[model samples]
Target: MPQSELGPLKSRTPSSERAVPAQELRCGRRLSGWVLAALCAALLGCQPARADVCPSKDIRNNVTNLQTLENCTVIEGHLKILLMFKTKPEHFRGLTFPKLRVVTDYLLLFRVYGLESLSDLFPNLTVIRGNNLFFNYALVVFEMLQLREVGLHSLMNITRGAVRIEKNPELCYLSTLDWSKILDSVEDNYIVANKNDRECGDVCPGAPRGETLCPTTTLNGHFSERCWTQKFCQKKRCDATTQFGEVRVFAPFALV
Candidate 1:
């Protein structure tokens, strides 16, 4: 070898001398894995720690059976109450979900015997974020023979579905509820059908007969008052005294 070409003999550094520590390299890999997992969870809206209380199951309208719902605060899927032919109405009178705040899917109440009202059942339920499997309604009440009032008094929002109230023969307060006051917006996505027609006449005098009348525009602009009070004014012109007078007159002329 020529002396000029081989003159520079710099000290050789081993590859191991520049290598990262094993423990630190392993920790870096673990940190990267954790970051990727966190990003995936956020994008998928994963709720791994919170399991569903009632995962797409039906709850028969039996008092003893429904006690399963007493401690459930959130239902990740549907909550269906149906087929209470053997149960009495009073048995459901005590059924309440004081802690329930949200139903991630739908809440269905159908063919419940003797269920007079829902006002007391879900008093604290504030939201129904529907990820429903069938229809788009977050809440469905159908064919409840004795259901008189929908008692969702504290319900403030339904994030992604409609509302359906139908075939509840004795339900009377549907026409009076100002749904816009409770929900963010009804958006013309409701179905109120096959309820008691005579009560409908008494509650919503001018509303069309035997059809869905949800988001009833003829509501007397009140939250819980009777709609018949303003029915005459809605149908025909009347003086202020006649409209807002404390004295009320029925068709058969009963004064109160």
Candidate 2:
């Protein structure tokens, strides 16, 4: 071959230019790794955390089951206490959750044989952000035969659902609680049924039928119908009447 045609062996291409492809390859690999890690993080963030189901078989023998429940700040699913026949109501005397703040789903107490009241269980629970599991009820207490009180004094909000108190024959205070004060608005979403009539004042003396009669009184020659006709009436007070006729009677003071 002619020397001119061979062209001086193409003077070994410059090292810097040769290194360009290698550099680009290394950068591509690094970018791919970063992208993969970012995608993984995004997926993890989108997924809901697993729920904590309490009252395991060991609950009767160990306090750890209760401790597990206490440790959760947010429960992603239902918090159900059902069929707890072994654990008596007295056993729950000291079971309190001081740090629990939210339940993202329904808080159900169903047929818990001995659970008398939830008065002390979750003292700090402030929110039940319902995920729509139990037909729009964030808190459902059903068929709890011995349950006497719906002790949700500290529960201030139910973000997305109603409250259902049913078949709790002994739940006497159901008529007295001011549900509007706790929830943002009741909006006719509360259902209280199959409870004790006398305890609920369903039949107070000289009261209209079907009305849960609270104590009546006369103030300053006025007949004030202090009754709890509506289930959500927080305070038991005599309803104001147009009749101002004077009548001698003894009545208790109705505190607000």
Candidate 3:
């Protein structure tokens, strides 16, 4: 997890790493991955002394233990893919880890039934690091009944906690995601009862001549014709002439 380049006070340790500031304090609001490493460790005041050891058992084997986490890039603990028995859903086509980008803690998928798309299974998962949370949810996709598009599009981040994607009945873009751009604060986040957006007739590559980059959600605030498909878009959607690997080299906006 030391590919570095994480600006503004970098903080992502797990290879015999140490330091803690009461589990990175966590106040709230739109920052970005590791929240700039816990705000670069609280503006150099540095904190966090412990926390990271809670996966005693929970990977319910299949797909060869998820292909042995394909040389994990950082998964210190808690990545439960619970209670399996004759796993289906194409057994996760081309199941990939391709170098996971950090789980640090919390990322469960209960009743996982033939997954649909995590883009390419954790496609360079951005970050889950709730440090450790299940009851408080760091990212729980419950009852994945033939899940549709969670397509993690290089997941933005979930630093502290909150997010309980419940009863995935053919999950869709979850309203083109706008969890305050990726939670900093906002509890009770139970992205409730999936499967609705007009029965998932989602269509996007460009929302009808609008040159798609997907990210438009407004209910009481108007505009909601819903059509975010390009694998359900994410952060800016990258730039430059897209023609690369790992889904257009992490630019927070690169999936064209």
Best by lDDT: 3
Candidate 3 stretches with Cα past 4 Å from truth are 1-56, 61-76, 86-104, 108-111, 114-157, 160-169, 184-196, 201-256
TM per candidate: 0.55, 0.52, 0.28
Model 2 scores a TM of 0.52
lDDT of 1 by residue, 166-195 (tens): 666677655565555444356634445556
Candidate that would win on TM-score:
1
Report, for every candidate in turn, its global Cα lDDT versus the true structure: 0.52, 0.49, 0.57
| Per-residue lDDT of candidate 2, residues 23-99 (tens digit) | 12211232332333344457654322232323221132333356667665556566766655666777778888755
Worst 10 residues of 1 by lDDT: 233-242
Colliding residue pairs in candidate 1: 119-151
Better of 1 and 2 by lDDT: 1
Q: Sort by lDDT, best first: what order?
A: 3, 1, 2
Give Cα distance to truth, residue 51, candidate 1, Å: 10
Q: Native-vs-model 3 lDDT?
A: 0.57
Task: Please identify which of the two predictions, 1 or 3, would achieve the higher TM-score against the true structure.
Answer: 1
